[model samples]
Target: MNAQSAADPSAVNRFLKSVVAWSALFLVIVLLAGLVDPRYLDPQHKQFLFLLGFIGMWRYSNAFMHYCRGMYFLYWKYPRMRKQADKLGDQALPSEIYMVVTSFRIPSHTTYRVYRSVFEEAARVGVPVTVIVSIVERSDEVLIKDILRRHIPDGAQVKLVIVRARGTGKRDGLAHAFRALSRQMPADDAVVGVVDGDTKLLPGCVANAVKFFKLLPTVGGITTNEFCEVEGSELIRQWHALRFAQRHVNMCSMAVSKRVLTMTGRLSFFRSKILIDPLFISDVEADHLDHWRLGRFQFLTGDDKSSWFSLMRAGWDTFYAPDSNTLTVEHPPEKNFFKATRQLMFRWYGNSLRQNIRTTKLLGYERLGLFTSYVLYDQRVSMWTCLLGLTVSLVASIIYGAQYIIIYFLWVAISRTIMTLAYAFSGHSINPMYPLVLYYNQVAGSAMKVYALFNMNKQSWTRQKTTLDSGSGRFDAVLNQVSSKIMLFSSLCIFFGAVSVLIHLTQRAY
Candidate 1:
């Protein structure tokens, strides 16, 4: 049997068992907590109880969405999928695609090799291409120009747009590139594709995306699914795979339902009109928010989310075509989960808040909640729930004595264990070994949650760098350091505490 269906019988049983266990645990917690203190269901605590119900309902909604998608895929779109393939078989797309590579400090050798491959890919698919290299640094201007001249295929329309920004920030560089592209693109036609320097477009990716755009006039933007492509050891490989799997699954579900809140930047194609419009244009850096001189409306934050938000606010809908995919490496293994999550918490927090604010003005309050539940709930509200639950438990312990404290701790441990198991069992539909992989993942995620909450305000965006390694277990170095430090500290604390207790016991005997 294949990996996906290898242990179907056992997997089915395990899933049923997990459902029963979770239901029993919920019943026990409710009965026990009620027996201890009946006030939990009181009118005053009803808001918290309602919040708990809301979270439960959200999960049920997600499950229902998946079920609907499966039904649609099997019954409704089964013929459509086949027909689309049959019609488009071996046909060349007519639109010319220019992949604009925007970079500031990228070295010449890297530029030549990366763009050369990109150029070749475009050529292979019969798309006439122009590569516009927008240099953020003036110093690399001559070098990048020289690299393009030597590497670009003859008559391939390779042009260089060197941009010198007064402020050397990521946003500034991207803004400069967008502005330059807007001016250079044909006023009547042309779809400019935006891709990063580090990203590699897969075979036929451009043709597929352009074809979709050609067929669907309403599509203002199209993006492919992203994955980490860097070589690594088994553990690191698993980590990257899991990360990619989780995101793609979520995005696929979102895309099919028209629910994706923000379009990613790995490889996205935009209609030329959207970028060049007077409303989207601004003199400020690309990464920063721009205040419209025409309407006094402020649109802040840069990068992918910012662009998508601007488009959505202007009444443009983004369509995600998963076939147009690419791979780019993630920031390598972090110094610790704490450092990594600290960065994520701040970015997600700020972005969530900013999006909420922006979308509320556009979509209104009630409609905004639907979007928030999908995109913002896990990053912002789930963390809030965890924090509130912990605080309530702490307060209850102080007032109701040690019994509640023991029960709360036990409840948390049991919940964590069951969630880890459920995640493991879910992985069986993909790989039998995925359960074991998820066990490691669960522990790491829980530890990161602790770290994220502790350093929630440390806002920084530095990417963690990894040195190339040609040996086994390369990313495990930092993991070992962290594990050893944790063990050493816990051992010392336990030893001193045990000694103090022994002395106290001896004095009591005397």
Candidate 2:
């Protein structure tokens, strides 16, 4: 019997158990909602039916797509690819790895941990590993050297080159490292890895990714699976973990198509020749999108997105290393939960929105595969669709009764719980807090995306305390911010006003 058949009986049993558990939970939720209000199923409430359809189209459709894609990845694509990777491992390949680790003002302890992890992994790889350390602090040089001296094995062929940059931003730090690596004149087959200074690689991280290069010559870059070391409240920790869990599933799904969207900067591997290209460094240093409203603004953050775009533009396929794991140290950007979450979301969603527009315009369906291209388009549509449920709930509650809001919450709870269960089967711990965090992301994150779309040019690395130039002066920046806020406020008012009008019409019709 094949591997699938050898495990078929156990897999079937697990599937049956999941179905039973999910059905029970779902039925319980439905029964509870009915007990709260029989009007939840009132035949006369056509408005609620319309609202339900809208919610299904806007939210559930994407959820369903992710479910299907996740299953395909777990069952078909990953297993077949794993077998191929295993075969490739049997052959010898001349692969040199150059890692560029960018550090700004990371804590000394964190810096030491990151370097130790890198050097240890480099030794384990048993290849020529050159780590280009980019830092703004002169003091870190001594610390890094000491760590490398102590941690790296004595016989390991590892070299450390420290490059000091002006602390301008991460982009500048990375640029300096890339320039230094390019000066070395490495071979085209060499693998270049870019990682944040706050991230630690697990054992076999580099070796796991290198096999892909030998297996697929056309592959330009591969990103690793990332976990985090979050130091904060339980809520914050769970929130961060939940995001990574969702990210893993999404990355796996996209990798099946060999077009993973973003080669995450946390720990992404690339072809050495690509990093040496002048255009690649230039794009990474100064990448921007032309916005109709805000004009052309250089990107300040999201260097990962910029690098991913460059790879896509150059027609290089990207993959994800599911087995390669990195641990990121998370520090809260703001003291207040709401403020911290918003600032982080603003930077993240802003980068995504900026890149989404430019990538679609530049690459399009021809360059990006059909499925990947459609996913990119869906990013824009989902922004609006995600908000519809919340908006409609509020309007309907004001018109009909508060029970509508209760029913809406119940539905969200049930649906998100089901979605989170699917994620659990993907090998992540099924946190009890996941359902709440999932809903929080969908509702709060959607609003953040809408704000980001309007203020696409406003880019900043919240943690690094740096902002990108929007190709405008102080006066223009102020004006743009003010104008964007006004537009956002007006849009929100119009959306609610239209919902109110719809509710009135539905009330009269019924």
Candidate 1 residue-wise lDDT, 1-510, digit = tens: 456654698877767765676667566656655554545446664453444446446644654565456345334553464357437754425445566666544445555555655666666666556566655566556665665666666766444555565434445556666777676764444676777766767777777666655555666776666666544454455455555555555555555544456656567877777767755645224323221211122223335677676666666666665556676744443545445544444454454455544455556535434644445445544433334334444554565454445555555544543433433322212323343344344444534444433322223344312111213254554544455467546744664564345334423432
Clashing pairs in 2: none
Worst 10 residues of 2 by lDDT: 86-95
**Candidate 2 local lDDT, 240-337, one digit each (tens):** 88889888888888988889889898999999999989999999998877777787778998899999999999989999878888999988887677
Give the best candidate by TM-score.
2
Which residue pairs in model 1 clash with each other? 171-286, 171-287, 289-300
Whole-model alpha-carbon lDDT for candidate 1: 0.53
Q: Pick the candidate with the highest lDDT.
A: 2
Error of 1 at 163 (Å): 4.2
Q: TM-score for model 1?
A: 0.61
Q: Each prediction's Cα lDDT score?
A: 0.53, 0.84
